[model samples]
Target: MGRNTRKRRSPLATKVIAGAAALAVGGGGLVWANFYASAHESGPSHNRTRSAGAQVATIQCPDVGQKLRKVPRGARAGVDRELAQLDKQITEAYARLASTRQAQSGDASYVQNAILGPLKSKRTAALDRIGTNIRRVGGNTPQGLGRFAECRGMGVDQPDDGNGNAGNGQDGQNGDGQGEDDGQGQNGGQGQDGGQNQGDNGNGAAGPFAEDFVDINDVQPGSRDLENGFAANGEGGSQGSFTAVCGVNENNLFNSDNLIVAPGVDNGAHHTHDYVGNQDNDAFSSDEDLANAETSCQNQGDRSTYYWPVLRLQDGTQEFDAGDLGGGAEGNVGKILKASEAEIKFVGNQRSDVVAMPKFLRIITGDAKAFTNGVANANSSFSCTGFEDRQVTDKYVLCPEGSQVVRTSNFQSCWDGQNIDSANHRDHVAFVQQDGSCPNGFQAIPQLQVRLVYDVPAPTVENGQVQNPYAVDGFPEQLHKPITDHNDFINVMDENLMNEVVDCINSGEDCQ
Candidate 1:
């Protein structure tokens, strides 16, 4: 996150925005998931949206971790803890902002004076501690940490969504909540309801708004040039793939802690994760503990931990974690949706032969904070079972009667040879260049790809309300935007097994 992230445009998706009509169905409402104010604003500022009664959407703070270039090994743990606290602070601030919508609509200075100001004070202290932690460990403190203390309110002028909050101006539509022509014409009366029933606590804690979903048919087909350079190479290349038969989280190993990014912090993720592979993983799971834990993989040698935010059907079913912090308590209410199949596999890079990855190499694909942090790191893909050719990165795919929902996460396959992990947890590894070659000084490693298939009942939009929708658990501030969906992995394969997997790829053998 500290490093300069390269922007690479691929043939992954034709367009990331929802087709207008795709969101107007049954007055299902619109989701301004990408409409937040800039995070680069110096301090708290009014958005001056379409109306003076504009409401706050989500909190936007400079991502402190993403700005960090490095933290000495001795200071990494403390710095990580501080970074997690920063995220925690944002989550709490956003929750407060969400709950106080009525107040936000009335007083213009309310958010700046109350929410943003207090949040800044708290973040300032945390950033100071991070600097102290670095200096205490004989590491130079990174500059500009203090400048990130200020955050701003991100929102749009919103119609009073009958979802609960009041004083938010008024509904834009007239009669029937049906058809009414305007700037974009009828829109069938469906429009941004300023995020549906955000505080409902039935389907979700905050969101997964009606507009967050789109008809799979509405998405344009995305294309990818699937050249792996194996055939083009005259000399050598790793063309084969390896599969890890790690079942989905059938064991219900769930938690809201992120061991890689937020070690030692409980509920650091602020959302639940469905874990497979390592049986013992939580805020306190040390590398040693993970190494000794039983695994769900068929080949016991693959003890690596694989996890992602748990998908939940907003069916009002009370799950075990209904009262827990990372679960329903934090607005992630719903029936937990277990993936029917979790296809965990490692595939080779395209341009060159791959080298064995260091044991315990951690890679985080996609971005859990992509909702507010922007889509620079977002790579989550969604498609229906049969319509795999058509995928969308922002909208949840609604399948037909018999078709199932599918999620695909492709991890970075390039590694910086030296570090097993980096301060940012991402800088040590990178996605391949647009031409299928690793960046200079980076080597190819087995890229992990996970396909999670779910047999979820199609969520329907009826009379402006979406029913039984499924959304990945996420920070309340993120509003369950599909772009925030992500996957995490830590390489724990035994040295012998790692060597064997490398051999399988280099020898052009796709083996289990």
Candidate 2:
């Protein structure tokens, strides 16, 4: 997509309300301002007060190392069944909770007491049962069975407080009828001016969706020109542009069941992913593992693992409705809904014979946390088809009538050429020049751009015309507001396909 063709909108507006409850001391007529403000502010204040009933409990995982035991061969089926049951239970519980909230018109106490409270208890019991089954099946490790169970209590009852606490206030406070403090340091008795600030939490924390790392303001528009070996007259039949399609990675929900960060130690991507390509790709999978595994890619040799967060329709059949299931709990309400579209493409490269990407090279692009933080770039584009002028950076993009909402992520495409991986999963890879060439000391690689098209239902679209954005699962409530989204990929390409890709880039020919 051309950046110039789209019209950009300013960041969302943040409204802060300031109120001061005054008290007159004795007969002297001295005044004191119990001033409370809600604008995005920085630093800390000693005057902050939280309600007693609003505290949320935190859950931590047990420490476990790599090399945890996999499910025993004979017990695999049973383990799968048990896990699936737990998944169904949790999904249904959330669905019921969602319904109750709607029925109560979002009465916080009713939702918490009648819905979430009971659901939490049921989930806890379900998790305990799953844990018992895991031990019986010989998958006995903190990272293995325990990790999956750990996810059962992974959420907070109250919404996120800008300062990392769990509270009910919109900007940050417990839901109880209590005053909110902006946490900004006190300037005697004066109140700070409130205004709309982009990508900043009221407490000076980076908004959940902010992309502070990349300076989007400095990114030059993408170009097709190849640098490095090209002559002024354009030698070697260079086309100045190239595009290739990586085969669609179907919703392979269970191939590499392990996760990154803590291989073998944890269940892969605590929230699931729609995986494609390599069969053996996982946190523990080595180059040899990928080399031996079968693949779904058209090029049997391409074993790269491509994946991203799953998208769901807001009001689809997957939505939670009362009595959908036999029990009081609904089935799969807040669960993973089937994706309508999953397409991955390689769009930018200056050269034809790019070098093969190193094995086990991990690259994460975009910030998943963007839903909570504001994006660093105004160009983190979000728009519905046909409504090109109303581009936004919010985590959720509400499409207009007769329009399909889409999210396009353009990843950096310059490789350091020497290191297969880096400590941060970035560093080794860099963005190509605006002219579509590799930077100094960095070799050109195909730019990975992924686009996800969503089919949200009518209720998800506000007023049946404007889009009603929602956040990806597992993000903060604030994230449900319009914000940024991101994706991750690991290089498990077959050596042969990698060579072919390089040859195509260096030869200046575009091929799928």
Candidate 3:
């Protein structure tokens, strides 16, 4: 790659050339001197052209006795070699990023899962630079040469989010501090070793998986993952790992958009994540899976939202119920509380006090001898409704990410608590408290409402047809994929049409 300097022909050089020509007309010794001087000052006009061709052909001389220098082919090759190595490096970095994502998101530990997507997106962006550079590498323009030179030594630095190489931390900070069950270090999690392990329920669907978030935009039409499974394996793709597929090729298999379930999907024949085959009467079957399937077909629908009927229980008897507040009811500790308009008003009024520990309440708790921050074991008691005088003598509760007091009734509340006992429960629990007692000490039994998040992919579209077989039963056959229909052509056509109409009007003709 070479730079083309579009140097303007100087007026001084033009003047000198004209003057030399005039002197040459006199046919004296001054003719040669003026001619030499003018040539020296102006150099070669052909070499100074604005085009790239002229630049490669230009010969530059340093001084009166110096030899004319030409660009060496070896130098150019050396630059090409450097760029090639950078290209290779970028590709490998992208691969590692993709693999890391596969390992992290696929039912791995919580810490590993958070970093994968950001890392993948970063590497993808870096790889995108290679495409732009590659195109410039083919040109002889100045920018093209500069870009090639810039890429001569480009490489990816494994991203570090301030956390040391110990790995597995959101913000690269220390993890939730809940160490592994096997007593492994930070990096020694279940989904490690390039995502080979399965059966680890880090925080995803119950199945073997890869470590990448599948973008719904990338799912291909008539793909199997969406059409067959319950919400594209929950992590957003088949086993949470995305296989790279050509966007336009008919045979390309990595179509993420194809993972979306269409509207009105039937669950009886839908595919499940278990490759070993479904057992125990569709253990994976659920209503949310069916609803997510239906969302795919309708453009206005959301793929993630799901609806289901509420079951009510009262006095050891179970029955069907309406919705929450908006005709809904919630089950707490084997009792179904109807969420009527009056009950909704009552709950809403108490929410500000019940949700998360109020600042004033926290100050009171902080001063208590029983309450300590990050301390493993200390038991006193924070004042609450039920356990006002009850002393929790031996339990240690760890305040995790969502540490807040939720007031339910005048005598009931909920909070996140970690049972410090190594034998009973090590993980944080969304405990609910009732009758003035929080779960651990002052909290009720049905503490926090736990909502498991899953990434449900969107439907795919090809040849103007929507592709979301996940919304239906049976595996869908692959369809033709065309990614660039709107941006490249539709936009251009819109502008063209506008211009044509404007032209016709200007020409005094009726615009079509």
Compare candidates 2 and 3 on TM-score and give the better one. Answer: 2
Q: lDDT tens digits, residues 313-350, model 2? A: 32222222111121001111133344455566553354
**Local accuracy by lDDT, each model:** 0.69, 0.39, 0.19
Error of 3 at 99 (Å): 6.6
Clashing pairs in 1: 1-66, 205-331
lDDT of 2 at 29: 10
TM-score of each: 0.80, 0.50, 0.16
Name the top lDDT candidate: 1
What lDDT tens digits, residue by residue, belong to model 3 across residues 130-232?
A: 3444345463222322222211110011112222222221122222113321122322222323322121111011100111112222323333211101111
The clash count of every prediction, one per candidate, is 2, 27, 52
lDDT by residue for model 1 (1-512), tens: 01001222222122211121122212222222222211111111211223122244567577788888889999988998999889878876765665554454455466677788889999999999999999998998897789989876443222212232322222232111122222222212112343334323363225665556777877666542222221122234677879999898767777788888898887778888888898877778788988998999999999999999988887767676655556655567677888999998787766678899998889998888776576667787889999988877777888988999999888888899999888888899987876778889899998888999999988876433467788998877777878788999999999999998998888889999
TM-score, predicted candidate 1 vs. hidden true structure: 0.80
lDDT of 2: 0.39
TM-score for candidate 2, please give it.
0.50
